[model samples]
Target: MEKMILNYKEEELIGKIASVDTGTAIAFIPDDKKMSELQINQLIAVNSPRAGTHIIGMVVKMSRRLDETILQNDIDDKKNDDNVVLPSNAIKLVFVGELRDKEGIKVNVFKRNVTALPNIQSSCFRIDGDKLTKLMECISTIAANAVTPLSLGKYFIDENSTAYIDGDKLFQRHAAIVGSTGSGKSYCVAKLIEQMAELKSVNAVLFDIHGEYSDESFKRDGITQLKIAAPNDLETANKLDKGILMVPYWLLNYEEMQALLLDRSDSNAPNQAMQLSKQIMTAKKSIVKGTEYESKITLDSPIAYDLNAVLQELHKLDTAKEQGARGEKAGPFNGKLTRFNQRLENKMSDKRVGFMFSLTNEEQELDWLQKFCRQLMGTSKFNNGGIKVIDFSEVPSDILPLVIGLVARIIFSVQQWSAKEKRHPIALLCDEAHLYVEQNESIDAVSAIGLKSFERIAKEGRKYGVSLVIISQRPCEVNKTVLSQCNNFISLRLTNVEDQNTIKRLLPDNLGNIADNLALLDIGEAIVVGDATLLPSRIKVEEPKIKPQSNTVQFWQVWGKNDSTQDLDTAVENIIKQSKSE
Candidate 1:
């Protein structure tokens, strides 16, 4: 093969080697020509006695110039060009080598010759300058061939595109979106979901806590929107076509029951809950068989136990103090009582004593308790509704844990039932997850029944088709075990050192530059990584067009403006009139 060569005036020589650095070398090219940055992998001929060969190295850095002298002969020849201006003596040229050692010795230690100079030629394509664009083109090609219904518009295909998600691997498994507040975490999440939802074969269940995703907004294209709410409109509520939320008490495993029932000090809570569950099952079987008992039971049966029934039984067991033969009490019964049956019988007659035997007896107050159990057990329209959003904003703080735990238990139990083939995969979005998972008090139940269950699904549910999307402002507070199970990660602007470190550890080494750019990211730009993408990527996320109305107080305008006396009186009168109307 003939050697490829081109002749150019020596005045075109840009620079000579200034200093040799590890993995790269630097040369100060005079700005007289004002040439653009050189691309990596550009070959330059180096004249050396030991190796008079054309060497090539990729350009890793393009900005800095080092202090070194060039050969006077190369500079003198290049001075003919009007743009060529020599600073002092010579030009600096940096050579990139393929192999540094020759005959088991380093070559840079002794090699010295100066017959040739480094010059830019229009030969080989530069890898550093074009890699990003090449990758984007590859992605665009794959997306164009996608059989899935979603589309990638032309706007994301431009040459300057620095950020893009690998669209091929997204359907392989579930994904996660995590970040601190204002990290554009939500925007990334919405964009991905929007794309997925456009695909006809993909069915997504999004749990929107803030009611950010509504029917009106997500209705474009071929996607359908379903909203679940508490049964407020009694007439049409039952007939409404929506999914149900129900969890049978019998479905809760031993650990879940313990988390649901046992107090902190009860070391045997786990065992006790398990044993009690067995007893309840046995009792339920006996009641179904119509077994004879001392108490005259007709419509009410304690064996018809659910979560409410279990709670009632626990209350009875606690209150029935045993008393000695005369008036001494021993067990939960306050007065003279020895056994649970006797106390229950004694309370049956007196209205004030309260009926303990009947499961739904008002005296036992178990009737009121049955509502929650019925909600979980009965196939009532309210219970089996799709995507119920429980707005606990008005609920008292003391009972919040119980409410969350109860709901979580119900959801888990319901999902456990549907046959694997018939089961509809559900995605539970836990917003402010740190509040539930990190709390020292009243968290064990939710932790065991909710967080642990979700974590298991995160790891194993892709095959089973169940998924979880956990959102949190404080990543440090999230359980590491749970966080590690997440296959996909959408990281937003995180200023916290600990949080950044946590994310850095999860991301691959190739994304180091992308991670460094996190601090300067815009409000809706995020770095997405993990299984759902081909490689780590930075993407600009689109905002939701419509969302639930928020009650943000306009304190500045309200307080800063002068309040008119007439307006104040009118507002007070309107408030009083509204109160009277209620």
Candidate 2:
């Protein structure tokens, strides 16, 4: 009732349903009304069998066809006009939902399903102006009743209508934000960040693949910014206080170590792996020789052990001489461990991956895990360390998958181990997820090892209180498994045919053709659909007060300028140092 009631008047009549089906109906507009008044995606309220309800639908297609019967007056002018055609205009309406009256309830409600379909000849009217506003308001009001409703932008159907979605469903069941390179993907993320920052308790880690988020605006009062150790940070990164994050190699499991160090092509790969595992187990045992952990320490345990000792043992086994019946022959693994040794030694010596091997004495201590997890996943009421934006720009691409996977595994593992009742839920905002979450049977060993962690999270993270927000510019390249698990999508302008089809295939069968609008969307405009939204809508994203550093550089404007303030020396020095430019 109230203002939500669709008080249809005879003066507003546009058409009558001529055909009805399971999920759609064809309405024949009267010849007196112009087809120009109808538009694609225009909301329609068709008369229903129920007393106080109407079948809500949108005009998906329209056509003007010639009537079969010849007009009596036009029959006389048959020679003047061929066949004397009388055109009839009709529209195809796909039923979306239903609008029900208050019936004594405090407010009218719009359910996603209709109780009855409109029969043939039912009058249909255009839902515009007041009716459109009221209908959109009903959906918004339903979400507004939630504890954490997310306000993204205004509906394109009605600019006056502010769009909202269920924030809990958006994250709890996972979500994805996909678009072209400059299609405001980052702006949407920054908008979400700005909104989440206003809440009392928010715990999330945004993996900043590039250093774009290093700007001051992203460094809000409650957020912490951290960077992976670079070649230059080796000498200075002894602690985690000043934002240098060290994920020591000891945190990696056995298979991860094999993927990182062992050469799979080598014939001695299996033996080399077995010996490496044995050496690691021995090293781990030394740390807890006098404690109960000694018996339970496995090669896969997350315990700080002497990697140098493992190396020495592998070398000994590599060149070991056997005590044969004669003088001395070769040992079982004399030369099998040579390639493994070389790879480990080289990676350990490389300063680029110092974050994994170059840990200080303090970091090697048993209590380091407590401090590390606390700083990254802490839920302090003051929000000092609740939100973290970890920058991995300086990390080498060769090992990017390994390092990123390591960090994600750490977060998920910690949450998995925590008691369910005491779990402090966290969101993993995986920026540029396509890099590590690749979709192919031919990915390399490192990427495969890395992909497993994310796939597991996509499959089972919800039960453990972990949510993933996958943000990428290319949906075609991102793995479908992870993308399919997402229950919500905020899709922006996508021009590529493959990328558009990727999204089209994922949409519900009824909404499949909606992807046709993907290429036509303007910048900052997106189609929002999922369990979070009561109605799939096209919205214009609101401009965030604090925007990300993803603005496209005005190349032409910069080129015309006569400014020579650019520093060549600093750029050369940064490249030489294998670090980010200041």
Candidate 3:
């Protein structure tokens, strides 16, 4: 191949170097006629003092042309007198050095050859033309080879040299998918997870709050799907195949327990929570004679400390009568006695009084509480699997935090036990991580496990085979510490300045220009950064072949419907017949 070259006359004006930026260098182009066409981001070659050498650099920017009147008049007079007017376009050339080597330094310098100068039309350095095409092509080839492991059939490449996906690396630490509301964050997450699942080595757990994943019947892939409902739906709840979601009290460390149970102001709250955990474990072991300490406890076991029981105990401690000369003492033993008495009294009382007491006193609600807790932490013997979903859809909003915390604690405990042998690497994917990490909310359990345990996993998870995937729309709403620890990031379109800035700070310095490209990203397109990619890539994310379609409702079409009487008599008859059979 013939070498393309640009020759500059030594007599031409060589203006001084102006400025240098991250991706480009700027210099004053002295030629007045060609200055108007000197656009930003043009490519140019720098001629060095050394012979037969040329350095390639892109023109990131150009200095403004200095307006002068005498120079124009002199040119006009020369043109009319048949005197050749020197081409003002040959003034000066500013060039940015390209990374010719892996270290990204400018070593090759352009050597000017005055004897064999090419004509202006034959010159490779021209304004408003694609100078970086060769360099972009080189980078694009590297990115294309990086994604070979993903097996993405075909993808459209962006013309602007902004986005590409590198699928060659393992993403075993932590990752987050973030974007605006309509920016396809969820679709990207689903697609990414789907691809991961296709990798036979990967085992993932997705916490789907919207029930959108229930349509797994669409994909006949090898996946176990389970739906947990409130204990009310006995038929469906009983049919779930996965084991029940149970967190043994003994599993939480001191700090995690404090976050779960104690008030924030309580100086010894963490210690107390730890003590409470130990006591609960001891009591359960004593209750169930055969179960060993720290062993997995089933829902049917008598030793299991029902959530209702724990709450009832707490209530008793709160409302205990001070031990005067004649009054009962306020302690664990006395509290348990009081709780037992309260239960006995409620059982013996009249229907109205019992009902009122059960509704009013927290201690009196123990029986129903036990049932509720059992439903959440119980195991199904039918398929010999635990019930993973407690079906909190029927759970009241106030106590949702408690349920969430309890479940998180359980997951942490299971992982902690397996951490010793390095078995069964568990990954916890928090869909709306912002909600749990929010400052105001009482997500102590999740915060404890997330910050302490999950953060630890983020830092050292790859070694232990543990990982975390946090998906959130508002990056600003998430904890900065946790966000900073993520080794991988799949950022989608984010219009919010704060969210954009957060991503900007997390990405490496070389990717600053790539971060600016987020706003223009299309749906399902993302700028992938961090450990998983060799470089920041504009990846055209593949959509899951069998993903649940959860787009917004078409209100206009629904509103176009006309009212009609559709056999109310048959509906009522069917309801009555169903009730009779029940």
Candidate 4:
């Protein structure tokens, strides 16, 4: 026997179907009484032409007009005694899913596919109150039954029922969580992190661009806080013990090094790149002298080498003179490497990017790469299911993209080279992704390199056990290719027309009406639809127990206070020091 998905009483009937399309149907109410209480987005069901199936849809548009019969007759004398209006009302709904009578072991099964359209004059019933709640509960059961279920919050359709998005599906394919500023993008991210923290084993690294997620609130396991080594750290001695990470210049491949040091507009750019490449190979080869790598080392090999040695070699080329037919003549490369040498020297001395040039005793060893990658990729460090928050707050803005790319590339490359059995899955929660992954690819070469690294992850990271959680405030500005690759979307309020359109394009054509409601979403509320979610709908995302620090300040309230003060001297000193730490 098949169970009824929605048990409705005789009085609950709203109308009868008037017309049908490929995936939509129109139903006209028999009277104005039924039309008065109807609302947009209200779920409704209609009898399908196929036996043992019902089509589920949402009220998209409601219209009422004068009945045709009333206009046919008019009498002046009758008008003086009584005035009455006859109205015809109808509602347009797009089919979202269908309820089946029986499917294998499941009875009254609900699916996102409509196998058949509703029949003409089919009775339409409004899904409300108890029926709505039970239907929502059934969806919850589907999520709860998943192999790796992830509870997000309660469904807005029925607050009493909990909402769960399939976690396995969410990460297996890429996913995106986008909204306008203060739309709770951070709140939703925190909820995901809080859940990951409580699990037996979870692995993810959040790129904290604005330093908002550095707090250790989710203590189910420890959360390691890491900061890119800043200028102040150079004077203070950069150390891993304090969670300050130093990415020595030797770690940069030949191309990345050029992006940081080469001036693209310089006429001598080609020569400089060649010289830098040659010197890097020479410097790296010195470390592997008489070893197996001596014959196999490449210029891009991430081996800790002496940049000072490379500097000396470039200086020799800049000033060297060779015997010529006449007298002493410039060497084959004399003066050609001058500009390149100066640029490299300037970057090495610039304290703002000291992280990339500062190489400590421990960082100079051959095993340093392995140690660093382990620290970054190993999420279960010390038996804690802790998330690593990589803070790029102190990194200089101009080179921030390159630095982020450097880290992302390291993790990705290491995973790609690892044995299949040894490789573990890792998700990058990219906060403020728009700053790095831009739709327009020509602005910053440094950022462009970074964008490619991420794009590769979006395209083929699944096979390498890598996934991305692209978090952004401006969906329109993000790379369309990367955003399109996301199979799951948890979108908060997006008021901008372009951003809304961007999301609309990512969704199926039938769900365009749902995308239209992006502007109407409340804070902490989101429209979740994709592979991870079974029923596409809105949900008030559960408040994370450990909230991130990305909160909007109460500017008006602060201005009204009389006790506010500023330490100008201290502020200036911190700015000069390029750090907030005392």
lDDT of 2: 0.84
lDDT of 4 by residue, 190-300 (tens): 988877776655778889998888765743464667778777776454366566788888878877887788888988888888888988888888899988788897887
Clashing pairs in 2: none
The lowest-lDDT stretch of 10 consecutive residues in candidate 4 is 73-82
The 10-residue segment with the lowest total lDDT in model 3: 352-361
Query: Best candidate per lDDT, number?
Result: 2
TM-score of each: 0.56, 0.93, 0.59, 0.92
Q: Which runs in model 1 stand beyond 4 Å of their true positions? A: 1-63, 66-135, 149-168, 214-254, 266-275, 286-427, 437-445, 544-582
Superposition TM-score, candidate 2 onto the true structure: 0.93
In angstroms, the error of model 4 at 358 is 1.6
Candidate 3 lDDT score at position 64: 49
- Model 3's TM-score against the true structure: 0.59
